[model samples]
Target: MLRDRLLQMLPEDDAAAESVEGLALTVTDLAPGDLGSWLADRAGQELGLDVAGRALQGGGDAWAVAIADESGTSVALDLATIDDADLEALGAWLADPAAPIAVHDAKTASHALHGRGLTLAGVAVDTLLAAYLCHPDQRTYDLGDLTVRYLQRELPTGVDAESDGMLDLGLDGDHSGARTAAARAVAVRELAEPLRTDLASRGATALMAQVELPVLATLVGMERAGIAADVAYVEGLAGEFDAAVERAALGAYEAIGHEVNLGSPKQLQEVLFVELDMPKTRRTKTGWTTDADALADLFARTEHPFLGNLLAHREAIRLRQTVEGLLKSVAPDGRIHTTFQQTVAATGRLSSTDPNLQNIPIRTAEGYRIREGFVVGEGYEGLLTADYSQIEMRIMAHLSRDEGLIDAFRSGEDLHRYVGSRVFHVEPAEVTSAMRAKIKAMSYGLAYGLSAFGLSKQLGISAGEAKGLMDDYFDRFGGVRDYLTGVVDEARGEGWTSTILGRRRYLPDLTSDNRQRREMAERMALNAPIQGSAADVVKVAMIGVTGELERRGLASRLLLQVHDELVLEVAPGEREEVTDLVRTQMGAAAALEVPLDVSVGFGRSWRDAGH
Candidate 1:
């Protein structure tokens, strides 16, 4: 009857018609007393689960779970009405590691369950992550979309078919929500094998199981145990930045001899190009451009006081906004819980949102001041930060197998200094700071596919000089040049690139007739493995660090992961041991031709630890 209902709900397409041909669908409501017996009978069996909730952050008070077992039998449980004993039993069943379970987004489900005083485990497959691994280029992997793409049928909308003038399975009352959740659970179950096979084909099965799945738990811990914030300090910083913004605006108006809206690009454009008779920037359909780079360049050429004040105003405004966001994000518990997104970046990188802590500046004075607001929690002795130094370059060395670069890393001298000495034909000690600076730019720039023009713009040198510098560096490091060229050729031949961990990033535009698109893909090809490998390395390190911390029964816990750095709260009397444990775990996260160098720091606040 349910199969027939599905058929009537979906459109009359051949694929949809065939989807329900041999399948049996069943839905049942198990009373609270029946839950224990049902879970016992389903022990060691694979199950598909779906959670209905308002959001993942707090797992709204009214949340239920739909589960599908092996016999195509689906059941829905309303946790709100379940007794304490039944809820505890259900939590134990969900947390049983021996039981295999499949879910669309295990992280979300886990977070929701966590919010409801439960824990989710035994997640054999996360269909959402699997879909991402299979099709890394897709922007979204929504369940309904994946169901249509894989199962060839539209997911059920959970309305009583008879009431909605569609096929109904002799059902009535407020059973729609349970029925819809059960349908989704079944969809997730059906999608598991297909997505698993796709991941196997892409050679990312281990990446999913070993790195992504395990890291899901670690991320939930970090999000729930969000770093503590100094509320008074943050509010003070916000007020200070607001005053600074006003001052900068006043300076801008004073320079122009008139009060104009500093935030208005049109007004600024009129003041810059027309009233002041300054050279116009690149023209757009509306008017001349007034972007940050254009304004900076204009200031460089003319040294205009107004441009200076305007740039200062923008910077102050941005800092003020960032501080204000942090202030607003402080939860009632005095911490900022950022949401970590795993599938957003194609390169296997993790991104954070809802007051993104990762995008916080780390190089500016104001940035340092802002970080000072993230203080160690009350019970924590201090904060510890461990960062990888020149990790990308080291990865490049391993990938390229360039003896010159490898030897430089192994020689125990500064990387840029050693390369500078070789490029300038001087001893390492004789390499001047300016020479090392140029070499540093060129070395890191090559990994990013930086062209001569781009390098010149970055270093403020002539294009010819930049070109000559690159050529000279390549001549000294022939293996690096050959490896860079060969990576593109190999990716073009294979139609994808693989990181050190064998994570593939498919690039179909490699063969495009459009030169711009093809060249852009080529740049991506060059950078993908390097950046992606770095990401993989960090993920592995996070897993290892957390695993070791748990195994050793340490009280210290991981707080945040931003790029190549990991921040942790040091437990009282555990600082030295935790510091050593982190260094050992992170340093050995990946093995390559070059050693992974980790730098460790500690203090009362994130800023002090980082510095």
Candidate 2:
């Protein structure tokens, strides 16, 4: 209205009015290179305002720029839609070092702009990152949502903005776009302090500043330098798995004396109980259980060939599915670019999707073969797989302050073997294989709130025997048993559990009257702090390793993080330094009663690296 009214005050041939530009800038997404550098220089100064193409879209998805300091906002342009000359003009204005650029999430936008050859410098704060610090649990930290959430102000957005108490400009129109962008840029700048202050209030400033932010930079590099996949090898593995699937299917049919769908539960039920007249294992909602565990139990009792074939069939088909999934997700560059979802898991663990590199099986021989397909890329020397050895156990020992458990780790003997000896009343060197296996299972399982009954089922032993083993084990390591029980009790009393780093997981159901609900929450409460602390330690280690690599100017790239492991692609001649750095950084991620032990392996393929 102001511009139109002023235009009406001038004569039709008024020279000044004729040349004046209406929202004199084209709005576009932030792209890297010369234009990106230009925009980076202009962040945070009063500028001619128009549209904020980047701000309106979302920081991680786009870029923001200031026109002229009419309050550090201008017409934002989508680099995609704007004419070349208009873009160049916008670039020229942004080249001024005085203009300020604000982004929503530096992980997405900064890394993207870096890919385009423009590294963001100067006054920049990712408000999305700010919102994360404020409320780490909220997954989507979009601009419009955060503005309304933090500032009680809604930016102009959505398909129909006129319906809400927002700027009533059409979403597609330049005027509306400019309003949305301006509102967001201002919000990004304005929202930072309140969020930061909130972080300070919660005592989360160090977690955000020292841990998450630096780790995010590492994650960006990992996401971009995705692990290379051997396409031909993957295809060949799929073929082998296909043949195995067929053979397993044929064997099941022959063993049953007739063809049946091994994948179908109903068909398996008919063949197992009705046709073969086998004894029932367990009852389910539909019928007698033909589930994997139940079938395995039945096979153990009767040595049923059909059951064995069925299990084999299931395993083969699963391998094929994994291979097919990988083949489908392979990008044009021959790498599997798994998107690491940083904020998905409540325990602060990272999740991988679009091939889910984390879930790739590693227990079976075929699984090891599947890993062989993860090979080094052209520019990297080889892959390095480094992992913390029994990190969670060390954390358990530290948190429990259990003398015997600490001795087991500090003694430098085989941990499980030594533990088995104590429970079996034998010397560490005299621990039998079976005793060590059960001890190992109990050692890891107890930390996760595993009960005697559950452990019995897992080990295929009588529940009474399992109970005796647990009782004996706890007698030897009484501190661990006491600590496990105390964690649940504390959570029930306080309504939450805190990790060693002070991250909290609130377990509201710990106070519930319902026994089932209460028990589940108890297990979670008991498990959360230990697991969450390990997660914190790994994240800190990631940041340290990444920062040190950059500081030392090494060419090796951290590719994937699989729970307790870090997979790096080493460059030529940097393997020794990189390996030592990873071990040191990971080991120093946290201070525990016992040492943080790390195991490092490297080879041409992920399989070899594991060895």
Candidate 3:
């Protein structure tokens, strides 16, 4: 029999003892159909058992196991009819420590055998949980995928619930259950040691044990605490957006002297650059200059009514589309469940999936209307948002320890004004708005791999003038320039860069032979430390805030996280306490020379929380 063959495959000492002593098996309903078939096939192929003749009998529950003798002889034993002697014998076999116990279905087995007077433990070590805990980067839970990655062979599918035979062999046609079981068992057995090793090596074993694991338990809680939306506010704003889009569409058609799809970048590129003879700004993968920045520049250069109108048209249509998309994606319970992806970005920032709440437009007035769609939840008094002010710059200053930059922040002087004054060789008060604007552009541009040509295109100045401006800026802030160069050099030397908390980001391309590729890698290397450190600070703050709330038994819940901001759904009368808690936790999450400044706002809607 298959059971006897399995026993014989075990060591003689263990096999002989387990054969004399019967074993108990329990399966879970969530077990896939291929599990039984895969096991049967493996037994037949590897252990020389003919399990095809031992098909299970009539409509068995999703999970079942039979007790048998050492020689694979059937034992007529029922759980309800078994005496203490049988139960003790079965428990002893299970507790033997030598006989390896295999569990097929985890969930069903846990439920069925609970309090059955059998100490068949070990279900607590779940394969799915272990996989997620080990590699949070993977997005799916399919067992077949897990098996294909960890094991070499393909397993079977589906279960045979209706067949009747003594040994309860799986049907050839249904192998999904067998495959799933095998996958789970293999994953469970294989992953345990490696996961522990990785956790220990990363020094995140304690973090995982104390913080991440518990936070997972609270995900459903936060989801259930879904934020209230202003249905009427969203509906009214959506209607207004629709009307505005129509008007913009008409204006765009009027400017072009014909109707065209404003949403189609291809058509726009042809009309603007090819037909209209407008200068091409940049080339996209599809040989187009229809990118947002390029279009804005094209509008500025030509002063073409059509180009300006088209830009406006695109923005309006995009806002309308975003609103419509959000309305459709909202759950039936009126809560938006934006999935938090833990490891998508190379820089280690968390990304939002589904509707992607992180990308909700906020820079322009038209795009800002979408925020009104996120209303205060029922019984919740308001939505409170807090953001780090110039966090990346602060992080850069802290990491570089550039005295000038640190002093600029320490003296409570305006950062852009300081840069403008230094670059223009003027007193801080004499720095004009134009000077400040140029400095502001340069400050942000440097982080994005800006070149003299790119700056000339942006500022509408001669390339010589842009080059001079860059030279002046670097001369005034030599330490900042040197620090930026040093960061890239250090990354190239180490093969990776780490944030304050030891969060590492590999940058293998930093030493690439391709000039463009190497420069791009250098930019990322420079930016990742600043951005990633900020992200690490925020994550720590989130964990700290969650712990504080739970400790105090507060009802407020964290609802969303943007790159540098966090949104909390506040309970009635708890806004003040929650706000204080959040500010304290976030600001102290990291220590920097320039103190981390946090700005807080609250209102019945996201729009209201803007100020």
Candidate 4:
């Protein structure tokens, strides 16, 4: 059909007229009439145009007339402008079930024709989408890469626009229809296998077909459904934070001999470790430890006015900085749309970028003040915060099937007290405050690659004493010890580890040449299963919660996910219902040996949401 159309456009006087691989014709280009005649004359001579539909579609430009032969490639003419009737005709041809049309520069064409209410002749097949389905994590998406890998040759560029912004093919007497047809044929034929292989390899062909691809149709819908933000509330918080920073700076300057850089960890380390001579606890690459825990430890040992004041100063400054960053990052519509990075963490945990929602302040009293900045907008009643309670521990219990651990959660007992009582060889009621405190530290530390030496540094105790405490802990919870060791050993053998959801993370560096790299990889191997599994559970929960909200036609929107917590922006009257929905959906996302528990709270401000 394409060949017939090209042949019909040619001059009747053309001699030695023969179709070479379909549409390419050879006729003397002695004279020309209009654009159409010129194209027809060129088509007969240099333009080895392919009559085959596949060949025509491969050029990536719908209106381009390509000329190619066995020697090499060239373009005869490219139509920069075409009327509606011509476009419609092209579309009609492409829409035929048996006919295929190829177009390059679809993105630009879409934009250019948008104002005229015009669209391409046929539906554009996204090569980028095909490539992504093949390798979801590959970083680049160049057409050149696709062309080389699939077609095994380079396509012509700089044809649509010249340096002088005029239509010029730079023909160089090499333009032929055969070359054009060959290039197009190659692209169309080569694409199918890569697309199929990619879809199969990532286990994402179904996900793409069933979920991700379809969901993109809803992306514009969601953008249009942007959540409201309290502009006044945000601005008020920024003003308050600015005031707090000034006060904290004053306090810090008075505590130290003179004013110093409060934000500089190097300066703080010098003042705390060298000047104060506050028990050289641990050595960092820079010299002495200046981490948050180290600072807290230093404060405890000295009980010095300056150390306490400096710690307070650090907390206040950090809170102020976080608030300031948030204020700066708010979008024009007043809401903060933090970007979720799905693959940054090896364990398949999503990280927040742009404005990091994950690291929002929570623990310290000063940090808690920053929460007050996040308030309900005008049509919204308040914010609802829902968090999983001791989720990681519950997961550990389930995975390890430790009877004592499972019993601890099942009996509705305080986990730290249960652990403390077991470790201290005492009744739960008799577990001292001091014992519970130590157990709390150990519980969290264990998940973070803490060793006896690390624990000793954290607890300000002798390494031997720390080792004894750890041994007692393991003795009281033998299953946990066995589970941790078993996971590490299993991961070491497999060269990778996976979460409960089958999200695999390779750790080839576990056998690295560098000791530090290997040791770090070992920690990751031990930690990935626990952390990653928890991450997977939360992701499934978020997706489920989002779906349920949509199904119920609720007004509440999931605004942010901070590690283990979900922050929801609720409609004025839907707080109670929304809170229940969030807790229920999140808790039911997954089940392990131990039950999932969730805690819910609401407030006009983030601070009020916390108990």
lDDT of 3: 0.63
Report the C-alpha lDDT of model 4 over 485-597, residue by residue, as the tens digit. 88778877987776776555667887889999988887888788888788767767777777888899988777666667777778877877888888888988897887888
The full ranking of all candidates by TM-score, starting with the best, is 1, 2, 3, 4
**lDDT (tens digit, per residue) of candidate 1 on 108-142:** 77866776688887789998888888998897998
Q: Write the per-residue lDDT of candidate 2 for residues 1-611, one digit (tens) a residue.
A: 32343234335653322322322133333222434443445545533322232221123234333233233333444444445555555545433444454455555543544433444433234566556656655778777787788878665443233233123232342344344444445566666667778777767677776777667768768877888999999999999999999999898888877898777888888888989999987888998888778888888988978889898889999999999999988776788777776666767778888769998889998877999999999988999999999988999999999999999999998999989999999998889899999999999998788999999988989999999999999899999989999999998888778788777677888988999998988888888888889999999999888888989999998999998999999999999999999999999999899999999999999999995
Candidate 3 Cα deviation (angstroms), residue 597: 1.0
- TM-score of predicted model 3? 0.73
Q: Against the hidden true structure, what lDDT does model 4 obtain? A: 0.60
- Between the candidate structures 1 and 4, which one is better when assessed by TM-score? 1
Model 2 lDDT-worst window of ten = 49-58
Q: Using lDDT as the measure, which candidate wins? A: 1
Model 1 score (lDDT): 0.84
TM-score against native, each model: 0.92, 0.82, 0.73, 0.67
Which is the leading candidate under TM-score?
A: 1
Q: For model 1, name the residue pairs that clash.
A: none
Error of 1 at 410 (Å): 0.7
The TM-score between candidate 4 and the true structure equals: 0.67
